[model samples]
Target chain A: MKKNLMAVLVGVLLTLLSLSLIEVYYRAFVPPKAEVFAFVPSTPVEVPEARLSAELISQIQGDPIMKWRSLGSAYEGEYNAKVVDVSKQGPLGCCVLQGFFAPPGKVHSRAYTKHRDLLYDVHFTFDQRSRRITPEVSHARNALLAFGDSYTLGEGVNDEESFPYVLGTYRASTQVYNLGLMGGSANQTLYEVTKLPEKRLPDLPDQEVTAIYTFMVDHLERLICRSLCLTAQGMWRLNQPFYSLKNGRPYFEGAFSDRKVLNSFYTWFHQSAIVQGTGMVLPPQFTQEHFDFFATMMVEIRDVLKTKYPKLKFYVVMYPGSSDPYGSDLTAACKKRGLNVLNYASVDITGLAQKRERIAGEGHPSPIAHMILARLLNRDLPQ
Target chain B: MLLQEFWDFMRERKKYWMMPIIISLLALGFLILFSQTAVLPFVYTLF
Candidate 1:
């Protein structure tokens, strides 16, 4: 009987061991798709396609070159023929720029950058020209400065379709400068504003730069702690040629320490399939510090910009993420500091769809959400 | 006589029963830690 019991125990143990191995293998190999992360590019290339019709290619080639705004694609042909770096196209293949071709009326443009890959697509005429916000008009009308992460820079959206661009289009008289950069947190936002040139300050009509919009999501809260995770040894080999350790850890030597890169890499890794699939939830303990830092930064930015452009209006556009319970708390805190708070809950986003077919998924506010914000800002700005 | 002998054998092995109790306590500690640190915050945010 004892021998039989021992056999049963061994069988159970073997089954459990096999199950654990399978779970680990599945996570490592066939992990679920990352929902919110964008692709990072490995190299940069520019390609011109002659395969398109002579008329279309001519239009593209002839269009006066606009200042290059980082890495993005443009479309020219009927069916919206997309022009992108041939090498930067994703594993699923590059978009056929031809499908989006239509006479420009109210074109919807979206831009996204992942790793080193950048995608910009223009969707045609979902609204009228009056509904569109042009930068020229915005400059003519109000003193506008946009602050945020990559989304404010129109990541996964087109330069013209970016919120700043849209705001510019909406208010032809407003002067808008997009001080947004990818991977920027609230502290970085404050730093960027303080670093802006004085020459740029005089272009605004109001000595009080009437609007300062800061975009934020929960991910910003993770930056400091993650930075602490980088090790001294890891810092040494950040930018050198990539090498794998015996345990299969990949290392690259770069200007930044290994710990910095490792922190970002691990953060990105955890933020990818497993954590995102479960809905990008962060620990609550971080909420107070996150809100406090963000609020402090906003106040500092407001005071600094106010020193130069004293009449500056300040607002925070809460990036869409359901992960922070302190969301309401943050809004209330912002109110205490005399800043306008645009929480997702306050907006009429009911009309906005959540899928790719209608709106960008994850925490990204849909185009409709953008419209709501634009309208609110237009109405709220002190005349 | 056989029943009395079996009772005597059971009494000899009482110390072995403490092993399962120790494991249960360890598992309860883990459960409490996970609940407070990760699970509660997630639930609070969702609604």
Candidate 2:
């Protein structure tokens, strides 16, 4: 027994010694994956084409770029400090506290690509209620509420060039509310819309409303706290809003990390060198259940909006971007729930100059692409 | 400097068996510490 114990201890000692040496070599000599790839010239990223075009053509189209009042330079520190609790004023709210929003004012910042090319140096203006400013022409009785991730939030572009801004300014009688959050998911939108009647959404006028949700393929992974989503996005998703279906209804389950087992496993998995170094993800194949869950969330969101606005016209616009295997399954599931889907998956930018529809040095859609999409959506709007 | 002190204390106490365990723990601690500064940011930027 004594000899066996000694042998085991020595084995552990040798194993640890080998690992420590490798760690030293990796840290001292090996460059990060990003740095190593930076030397190679980057190729244009593939964005899937949108097939369906808008049918109802309107003559009231203008330049996607509009004007905004600048409130000077905004620092990253000050930007994070201006957080408002959109949920129940707790960490467990339906929408987690997004601290990166500039408080109720126009803030300017610059974005640079890895190649040192200036991508954008623009201003972002927030309204008095801390929403991204969308310029409205006239005080119209109808409302347009936009929701989704950064594409809907217009991350890389000026406020004037965002899809919501283009749509709001183009339509004279509709007031546009930009509920799109950067890196936001259906969880946030569901929570926001559910609480709309409670005055949480203070400025929304009670009238005919049209809610547009810009769907992305990756949102399926986000809906569930997938290992890839948690680790790749880092600590941000720790406090990300989590929801689960109970009796066919979506229930808020606090933050993603609030799930004790998943949080601990992913927290350890992210720190594990083997996982990080190789970029291997867990549950390598997403099953049909994942797609169904995502579609269920959309159903809940639709139901919430319908309860509030009886005449609400909800459109799920699948933004032209990366394609995934479960796209068809997800769309089918949404259709089963009687949701209106404007699939722009085949929206062709092939005729345009290569990469013209995208922002230079960044992957987000350019103002030109936004113009195309806005015009398509304009045709579908009820004037 | 602290590493040297730790080594000295281990030698004085004649805790040879503990040396490997301590080295293993310290090495892991050092690895994780360096990873946070060197690796995590690069991984995050990919998103």
Top of the candidates by lDDT: 2
Worst 10 residues of 2 chain A by lDDT: A74-83
C-alpha lDDT of residue A201 in model 1: 33
* Residue B26, candidate 2: alpha-carbon lDDT: 70
Q: What fraction of the reference structure's interface contacts does model 2 contain? A: 0.00
lDDT of 2: 0.58
Clashes within 3 Å, all models in order: 67, 9
Q: In candidate 2, what are the lDDT values of residues A1-383, reduced to their tens digit?
A: 57546655875777677766765676666543321111111122222332232332122122323112222221111111112233323211112434234357766645554444465666677776556788765667788888786677776578878888988867888888887666567876776666543432434546888888887655655577566545544455456678998987788887777788876776676565544554434554456777777778888888887877877888777664332334455667778888877665544532331335555544556665665667667766676
lDDT of 2 at A7: 51
Candidate RMSDs in order: 16.5, 11.4
